[model samples]
Target: MRRLKAESIFTPKGNSVNEKMYVPRSELETAFIKALRKPKHIIVHGESGCGKTWLYKKILAERKIKYEVLNAATVNTAGSISNAIRALTARLTPFETKSYEERKGATASVGVAKGDLQHTRKYDALPLEPYLELIRILYRNAGANDSFLVIENLEHIVKDEKLVRELSSILMYLDDSEYAKYKIRIILVGTTSNLRDYFSKIDSSQTIINRTQEIPEVSVLLSADAKALVKRGFFDLLKAKCLVDPAKGFDEGYLLNAISWFSANVPQYIHELCLELALEIEANNYIITNELYTQCLRNWVQEALVSENTRMEAHLNSKATKHARRNQVIFTIGLISSNEFSAQEVEDSLRNRFPDSTYGKTLNIPAILNELASGNSPLIRKTPKGTRFRFLDPKIKIMARWILVKDEGKDTITVKKFDESIKF
Candidate 1:
């Protein structure tokens, strides 16, 4: 085995993290493991970058179960679905390795091909029947052993009624077929709510939903778990040797908590923040102080804010001006509020910012807040403690600050200066 590099240990923007730095959440992992024991269709849905794929892949590998992954995002048409199935079927076939002399002899005889040796690659699109047959063959080859088929990013094609109905029909058939006998398990991973929307076009959607085991929404890591992850990445995996003086109010525990808190207990954000800090430390001759960490974190927040603003701008259309303004309301609320704030407080703040003439008189503050809290990429969410709401991620606050500064003027305080003024 090869040694791991410190630089590669923490992947901020990458989808998959190194296994050594993986922090397992017992609740989610246990639920997934239980689902894997039997032949049940599993729907794993969660926010993006919440480690749904990582957890599934890790558990499947640990269990030593044979599995094939198909990306549903690319399977938009019947032919594409058939191609995906064909690829999975190919994985079940065994390949034989020949000795060097035998390989050389075969290569030398390639020019003198017999009638039986002549072969042509098939280009004709396969119909639904052949696709179903291929699925049956795949399950049949599994024999007594159990296998997993993970369909990832299903939300991409969930809106196509034709594709959705066909996929549901196929899954329903394989699930109830006597030939399968529960030997092959199917897992659909997406960001959608339930299979409700995907299977809405099909009549047998009820049966499909009943047969499937839907896992609870994958949530961000707990504060304790997030801290442990930081420790593992910094001390164990990367073996970070940066030392900060105790007089400067920096230590392992404080640093861990700071990272966890600022990241809003999200695993991906934690990695991102830590990765930036690590790079800064390495560049500074392996010395890190509380001030350095804060500076790096502020820089990370500014970069994230710019990226998010750009994304929103790219997504906005000519008619989305009002929508953009409403988003600014949500962003402003997130920026000033601490962890949690009441709806009344948010409304009051909005009114104060955009007085009666502009938005105060007409804006339905509560409705806008509710919509923001409930949307697909929710920036604010209601807390368990009564009617108060808070930003789902700390990074949202930074974005909100960026919006505020941009709206004011170029002469307004920059993100770095603003972050410094605030005592995080």
Candidate 2:
């Protein structure tokens, strides 16, 4: 009997945790819960928009654990971090106890020099012992279940040695405790999957990584999970919204395959595409059709993917190079699932996708790749050593899928409407 609006059940950009729509990443949740219970500092890393923030927030809330999240991007500077810590654990108390007699009468002012009577403000510049205060406050704040300081977006400062060192210094201090048992811990969340490598590049990197425990990368959801989200939201929740049996003029069997393919296994993109499709049902007599889905894809591209599409168009073949098949070759590259690929792999993909097209046989793939990566409004970039390349953004491939289609009749590729690309 559970029910909700499409927008409420599906959120792409919103920060609110939709428990009704949440599909628990079981393995990830289990590992994270284990990490939380352990004594070591924790690091959770994955590609951007892979649900890192929501997962931890959901787990912490369920366990009723006390925690605070500070975005590293906002507190990029070391001084800002120190200021935040200072507010929590550092204080200055007056130590002036010296007795002084006030000039009550002319007798007290008997000094020959009147200037001598004015007593300048004085205090013993006492020792800081900031670490001691930090420990005291941290332990006090660490209630029955202890406390967690989750630093989200750790990737923002990993490149700066000073910030990383300042941060590691605190981590080292936490380990120096002798007798007292303090439960306060730190959890670092980031978008980069290679977080440890980023730290290892720094001098004395072991000092920080040694104190942290990193579970498996929270990469894109498994194909099954992605489909579950679609089924739960599109088929169940949308039905509850009084739009049961919404599929129209389309073979509903393919809906799951369509979403999983177009979403590229990214949960957020899946949510976004599903939300748009659900809206079509609400607006069009509670009936969703292939044409509606197709139009929704274009609307999504125009709204959020304008930049990627523009970049793609900028990297296309010129008018005089029409027969060169640049667009067709790039679409074949988009068919590649791996983010990092070499020119040879791309050429092979070209042959596989377009066996009839002679362009694959003669195209100078490496040179074309270099130009695409280095040209104006570059579509991709090469690694520092130039061994491999990847799309400048993952969204680029998604945009290409929606915008370009291969014309089997002519063995050519052209920008076309979504209906043309729909296999059904």
Candidate 3:
């Protein structure tokens, strides 16, 4: 009799995993290896959840190097930069005997001047000169032959021209500093929007940008990679089955069938979804079937829809007052709803719906275009002519359709009419 196959494996939750179950991007590995050999500043820019952080961590671990990581999402603001610097300084200070003695003296000296070291811990902001001095002192005290400053989510602070200039100066200073002759490195991580915006505004920032290494483009998984992912999931389920019972049930046929239907070679999405289906199958007694896997897919789609709704709600609330034009609203909605149109097509679509609206203005179009392309929208992506937009997320597309049908009753307004309102 053919044995009953157990379901898929458990998907790892909340960004915790060492071994990557997804297809490894060879370009990423190559870039990482080069950076490891020579301490070089790097910028790993990509869409969110495209494995930026994971790739960074993996490469660092594989090389067995000492480094520090500062998550910009947790602390990135005008004042947070000082805190980030201090936090990084604290970590870079090693625990060796010499470092301890050096830090002890530096602490004592500051304490003597300020009355107490504790009072200095809370700061509004550290002046640029003093901040640089502190970094130099810390490096000396720690006896670090080489050091690396890993800054993530730099866009959070890069928006301010002054701040961007200062950051540029700081990186340049450190890169050229006599102490860095031993090969200190700086690694900046952010989405592509961050880099684009930063570069457009700050001339000095180009100095820093030129020195950084970039991760290569990621393509869809190969046939071998897809098979490997399927195999990993199947084997995980088998291990689980052994623990539950010296299983008489659970066979390769059932596992292969499930893989064929739901697996798309998107590792991050596939690994987790497979694991979820596996758990349900185990609970129902190792009888994995296509129907149960289908249920899991349905659940995944629903979850994705809910997440997209939350994003759209936040986006709408923030920009409703700022971007009130009907055409602009339609453009944004189209951006989230479909990824197939060119800029001309979007303009055509808007013109058809609102022919009188001043949809021809370049300035207004670019602003909306920037917002969508900046990774802030998470749903819309820009093509070449700034007129085209694609929905990056499928769930956002579904939500956009719902919104369009619901708002069909409103008086249709065109770009020309919108321009008329602005006329004083």
User: Judged by TM-score relative to the true structure, which candidate is superior, 2 or 3?
Assistant: 2
Residues 357-381, candidate 3: write the lDDT tens digits.
Answer: 4456443544554465565555566
Deviation (Å) of 30 in candidate 1: 1.9
Q: How many clashes in each candidate?
A: 0, 0, 15
Best by TM-score: 2
Q: What TM-score, over all chains together, does every model reach?
A: 0.66, 0.74, 0.58
**Candidate 1 clashing pairs?**
none
Extract clashing residue pairs from model 2. Answer: none
- Alpha carbon lDDT of each predicted model: 0.65, 0.70, 0.51
Comparing candidate 1 with candidate 2, which one achieves the higher TM-score?
2
lDDT of 1 by residue, 353-387 (tens): 54533452566667777776774566667653437
Best lDDT among the predictions, by candidate number: 2
Question: How accurate locally is residue 156 in candidate 3, as Cα lDDT from 0 to 100?
Answer: 66
lDDT of 2 at 277: 81
Error of 1 at 279 (Å): 3.4
